[model samples]
Target: MKGKEKIKVGITIGDLNGIGGEIILKTFEDNRMLDFCTPVIFASVKTISYLKKHFKFNLNFNGINTIDKIVHGKINVFNAWNEKYNIEFGKENLKSGELSIKSLKEAVKYLKSGDIDALVTAPINKHNIQSEEFKFPGHTDYLAQELEGNSLMFMVTDTLKVGLLTDHVPVNDVTKHISEKLIKNKLDIINLSLKQDFKVRKPKIAVLGINPHTGDNGVIGKEDDEILRPALSKIREKGMLVFGPYAADSFFGSNNYKNFDAIIASYHDQGLIPFKTLSFGNGVNFTAGLSKVRTSPDHGTAYEIAGKGEADENSFKQAVFTAIKIFKNRKEYKNLTKNPLKPKQKKI
Candidate 1:
């Protein structure tokens, strides 16, 4: 679908010791998936071999010395690391963290170089992946810095789409990040992403309230009524179809989310909790407003079931499909906008 060629998706094996390898291998176990897109997993060949043996999986991957050697219809492993390291399943270690960052850096290099059409990242343990080299709270922040673009944590599924106004901040600190200007900027990012990435011509966005009961006209908290309402008004005045400071409690419960193209929540849990609850096994985490396309499984490293062969591959597979869908959508959007046609007028 990508210019008459299968899209090459570059994947980063999250924490080597986590369920990243298991999920990645399981996703590509069926050879038929290669027909949709070429997968290039950025991990050590030895790591994958070890996981295969440990899990008794029959997945096959083609190891390449360089990205140029990638086979057209094979699972390619771009061995980012060659050294022998201990991979303790279900345990967080410094070595696993280091390798995770190394794999991500390699994938990012190819992504920026246009070597891959999109990137699908495996889950990483945030605490273990922290190091002097990788010092962001999570993938969203790291990618924002590396790509030099503003990023929004947008969750996607066929049924619903959710974007967080404030991501990865503590509950106590979420309010500090909420401002009129910040809300408007985030809304603009979501709007642009809907049109450019998802191909929504005129996106209708729903903004959630921060306080309980939407601050009850300033009786509970002034931020929702004062900050969110004014911010949304300006965003709408700028010609974006945006609505709400709607109460978070009833928004999703009443199924009001189905009415809009995308929903914007004030904080992380306000949006993610509902989204994950509704679409945990099928949701895809899409990093919107990035120069390059990136998506990841909605769930994180399930270390408890890392080697048990119980981790679900549905989300990972959906991430791959979502990335491909978005990539194609963006391409078509570009083609449509490159030389837009004029509207016909009626005789006066």
Candidate 2:
């Protein structure tokens, strides 16, 4: 429950064997979660029941069998399916993976139908969840394909935001994917998302080059001068506040990352390695360029600490809060565009 007037968010529980169920229980510990948005979760009643027994979370909840009858208490659950099975905590199994992915797909239906404002996904392990029923590398790619958005994978924390140009690719193949067009497309997604989705007035983006020492001006590699720098010029011409081809190794030192609103990296590790180092436990992964808002925790399913009541729920909490906040901002942004908002300050 998010709105005093109506529901605001639809949450999906990820793999049950992982800490998804535990975090969902812990993250919604605040009574204020109900006030921010109506949360319709796509999960199983059986899984929910199991967690309540182990965790002993005392909240008024409704296990809804169908979407039409969902009502809020402390939590509202819409069962994606009605199957019940015993699951071992801190362990990976194929059935739990299938259940998690099904829940995600079912949640997307509500998103597409406008039944929910935004979605906050709990952690799911990609390796375990890659069976025939669930073939996605992760939620970001799955949501991109489903929503048909030209999207970039953005890992956001309180202080830093990193957008990947080529995600889930090997280091050897990273340079091959770094091109003028690819960088522009990723930047376009990041820039537009900053405006319409996040309400950033003018976003300054930093682009990292593709090699160590930023290619050392062709001493190490020419990809920096030959490729990335040219892309920066084109992005600037479009009236965006973007810079860099910043050095790959030194960019994260001494608060240098705070200089820009967002950093667009040449590849996956180029961006994530540093970001995880800084905000590993607190980061949130936001999928940019989708029509609907979607965010997930930055870290994956921590199987080691899944069931001991030891998994920190901060990132999960952040993911949920980020979705709810962005939902309101996007609404305001849409309202501004629809009514063509008057300028707040007059020209001097």
Candidate 3:
């Protein structure tokens, strides 16, 4: 596809009981969004109609049963399922989980087949979404299994970017999960992502330590000294601009993160807490290093303000914009690297 063409963006309606509907409706309500890319929402027209009525949204959409029927410059609602969903605001419903998974699976199918250029998923209830078919922790794990390439949960904004070394792992198992291979692989992914996805020619990355004060040189813990430092040393030898087992406590507070292009956290909360604290309502959860582009709002199902129309759509809007930007960046990167120029040969 050419760089100027509008890409197809597949969207999943997350938990019906949460703020997914509200945010989606509020975002597309402005017609200007359709000018960038065509949005294909993986939900029934009936479902969206219900949401529109509840929120009194004045948006117009095209309903279709097949992918070929999508209309450009309009919101397309593809009916993934025919059954009517019972949306009880601010409540957990197993049926809502089933529907959310259904929407995700269908959207992923189109995403894999290249019918869609990128994907922007809504939030789902982690606990309720668990079932026989979908046993993974969240979108990152599920997409990692379905799509090619290693996956990294990258939380991003215009200025700040953070990737997770270990995501969805328990606090006790975080130390056990850290290894040299994992660190190098994640660094490679982030470095590549920065160049191709974010247009960074030379990316600088910072790695946060597992323990406080980076194990204080083994006084606090041995993992930082034994595992993290050695891995970083080997990585640096390979000519990648990677640095630090910096103390997680002081990394953000000291504003040291601003010096680097991206930061890698040892675990989930250590990265997310600081990320959301800094960029909440504007940050996007991007699944980096995958063959296909996928992004989501940084926040999850906000059940408390589900149907009150109080949910913020900034993160969701940013997710869409980020997905479209990455899609274009990848295309440009591929075109630039498809055929390399040869160096001048020395006189024979």
Candidate 4:
């Protein structure tokens, strides 16, 4: 029951202008991909063909108009994007963004319907996608809305993991969003994700400060001592192991990040800047608190490197593997909780 033996991951091509198409095509380049699990891409045939032809990738694709005709050896594309894409690398426009959003919407349907086990999204341009059909700030919010409002964004790498209490918000608005209720809710989501999705029994997390030197015990800002500390104390009192309102400036450098399972940052850059600096190309952006397992590559639409075959598929591969891993963990955890005393069998 381990590995990718029983899972179906749905992939949504983010922005054709970025490295989304390139990495998707490159990821499926291996003929042995079928050995893992079935990959169902919710993307356009034309766009994928554009990537394959432009990048000179020779992978078999099962281009079908609907979901029923999916099979292996050829990738099953769900035809989420119908429009003929312009496919300009390093360019941002409404058309590409809308198309990316369209794929996301369709993929959600399959995920909710149990047609797909999880979702692996490629990178998208947040700026261009804010218009019209793209009403929400980004995929995290959009997925939250789709799931009826319960989703958290988590950036994960090998060495470090950081979850946001508030994401994609301006510096001014960040303080406004940090409340006791919001902090507790976000912490619950992180704790559940660590156990259910990440397969951790007990998760230890570090809560970061809103100011330098953790408010210097109120010399700088009272938010860390008054707001963050009380919140962390309440969370610890609830039996979850969490600590600090640690100094934002020195947290990444202290090697204390390794002590915790995840870091809960006050703002976007407070956590993401360090996460990105340490894990630029290999990080995975996972949507926790969702009914379905969802993960995406951490980097955004690199339009400058699009269609050049220079885009690395490692992150996309990581996203895919992470989805499969979560899917397995969900299945196994469910089994264990249901029947913990069932005889443990060693593979002999």
Candidate 5:
């Protein structure tokens, strides 16, 4: 990390049976991307080479077994595993899940050790990737346990940003999950993330309601009136620019989301449905409020479009860019805050 050194971004090859390989290769195909950040993919050279040949990509990679051997100007493939994989497109298998977790764990190892500046994970099948070692719902929950701070699933683009209060929970259980403490904690995370990760000076955040039309004063549901409103009021007293519990149905359609720095949705679908609809191929799923930086494409593993070369790499590329930007922003923030400016003495 000297002058003009590129940020080393560690990427995990998620669910090799899916489109992870396709998107990863597609993103690095344009050699100009190397100038931005050095990519270290956590998969074997054999796996990447198989993908290259399967997709007929004219991409070259520098394969290495250790992080010290990473070449800054080329795509570095760190051999997380040595075994050959059977690439069955659009199929779910335990082997793919095992490999995906292996890649992820190896990447996290480097990320924690400061071997990599940031991480950009490829999409993984949530169901198949489950085991005794990994029992979380998805990346956010898993990272929250492994990382230092509370994690928030922040789906972001340049203009639009949405964070979920409760992600990967069933709709039936979503209401039970929302409470005053949860709301305040999530708001705090979102506020801090905006200032440090996204560089917003004064963040104005809006929260969507649990029920339609925000319960219409208790007609639709009581959770919005009984729980969300009070929590938001308490947060506002802390001098944060927080508002809402607005009607979720028409918020984005009415373009009211444009007024705030970020929006906090009550549940997963409430946030991601509108978010994916708006920024599917361009949005980056940033895991905020963690000591380490990690981001991914907004969409999941597109099993249906696995090996057809139809998967758009825009979101994946954006994920890489977002990780690099956040890493630099966090570093700058740390440097600025490490030493506070002393107050000037009054003239005698």
Candidate 6:
């Protein structure tokens, strides 16, 4: 899946005031980086210029009014907005948030039209990028609404893959979100993603407990022993390579995540805290179970280092690479399964 074809990855300028433009420019500065995929950034020409000048980045871009003019081996900037806006670095304003959504909406338009193979979104301030037009918790929900099927926020690195069962919810509200049906459905999505998107045959999944020490046999909390255990049993009965209601506290500390292909966390922080600590500035957040491929840097908008030229672009680069890899993997998987070896009338 490495060099099958050059994929067109459409990028969104998350927040004009944040490090979105900086990382995008940094990642595409290396001419050798265009070997596997062509990048089309959905942003205004003025905005790109502002970032390039402010950061003192040595780079060039191809400007186009539409996706039809996208060219390979060069950074293509598709004009998502024409109006000039202020580049207030390290400050959040309504205009910056509005433009971020504009960029995102334009990128999604091309993505749905099949002009781009996958999408690589830059970091956005969840609070600022909120309005009547965009009223979701984050990119995961927004993309899910645009594309078909469910969406899972899967954080990936070299050694660990973590999926959250409950995303962007309060700690007190986490327990209400957990149920046998929900767990089973998420497990189904994870299993299929491993096979099709990741090419992991016979994938092993590790399920985490909601409570500390896995409830200590109903001492610490009954949700782990009662809710999580039953869900795991039912999931295994369905012929999945799954195990454990492992105690979340000691799971990463003891390095138990290395044994499985993916880990399912009951909530957000349980999985991400460890993943961020381990991968830091290089992890990619992939949205699984959607028809369109979407990925982003695991970290969010770092306002402190917005225009200081100190923001790291490794994670953004990984997001682009990961999107291309998944696109190729899905294509290869589709061709392999287009026809079965056995006759259609034959029963196994």
What candidate 1 gets wrong by more than 4 Å, as runs, is: 1-5, 343-348
| TM-score, cand. 4 vs. native | 0.93
Query: Candidate 3 versus the native: TM-score?
Result: 0.96
Q: What is the lDDT of residue 280 in candidate 6?
A: 74
- In model 3, which runs have C-alpha deviations exceeding 4 angstroms? 1-5, 341-348
lDDT per residue, candidate 1, 1-348, as tens digits?
Answer: 322358999999998878999899999997778889999999988988888898888778899878888877888899999998778888989888888999999999999999888999999989987877778888889899887688999999988899999999999998899999899789888999999888788899999999999999889989987788888888788888999989999999999999999999999999999999999699999999888899999988888988889989999999999999999999988888897887999989
**1-348 in candidate 3: lDDT tens per residue?**
222347899999999999998898899998888888899999888899999999999999999999998888889999999998768999998899999999999999999999999999999999999998889888888999899989999999999999999999999999999999999999999999999999999999999999999988789999999999999999999899999989899899999999999999999999999999999579999999999999999998989889999999999999999999999999999988996677999998
* Reference-based lDDT, each prediction: 0.90, 0.83, 0.94, 0.84, 0.92, 0.89
> By the lDDT metric, which is better: model 1 or model 3?
3
Candidate 3 global CA lDDT score: 0.94
Candidate 5, residue 122: how far the Cα is off, in Å: 0.4
Off by over 4 Å in 4: 1-6, 342-348
Q: Per-residue CA lDDT of candidate 6, range 127-163, in tens?
A: 8888988898878999999988788889997678999
RMSD of 5: 1.7
The candidate maximizing lDDT is 3
TM-score, candidate 6, is 0.95
Rate residue 181 of model 6 by lDDT: 85
lDDT at 4, model 4:
30
TM-scores, all models, native as reference: 0.96, 0.94, 0.96, 0.93, 0.96, 0.95
TM-score of model 2 (CA atoms): 0.94
How far out, in Å, is residue 332 in model 5?
1.0
- Which is the better candidate, 2 or 4, if ranked by TM-score? 2
Candidate 2 wrong stretches, greater than 4 Å: 1-3, 342-348
Q: Compose the digit string of candidate 4's lDDT tens values, residues 1-348.
A: 123344678999998788888888788888667677788888888877877788788887888777777675457888986778777888889888888888888999988888888999988888777776568878888788777647778999767889999988899988888889999999999998899888779999999998888888789878887788888898899899998878888888988898999999989998999998988678899999987788999888888777677888998898888888888898888898898886778999
Clashes of 4: 1
Candidate RMSDs in order: 2.1, 2.5, 2.3, 3.8, 1.7, 2.9
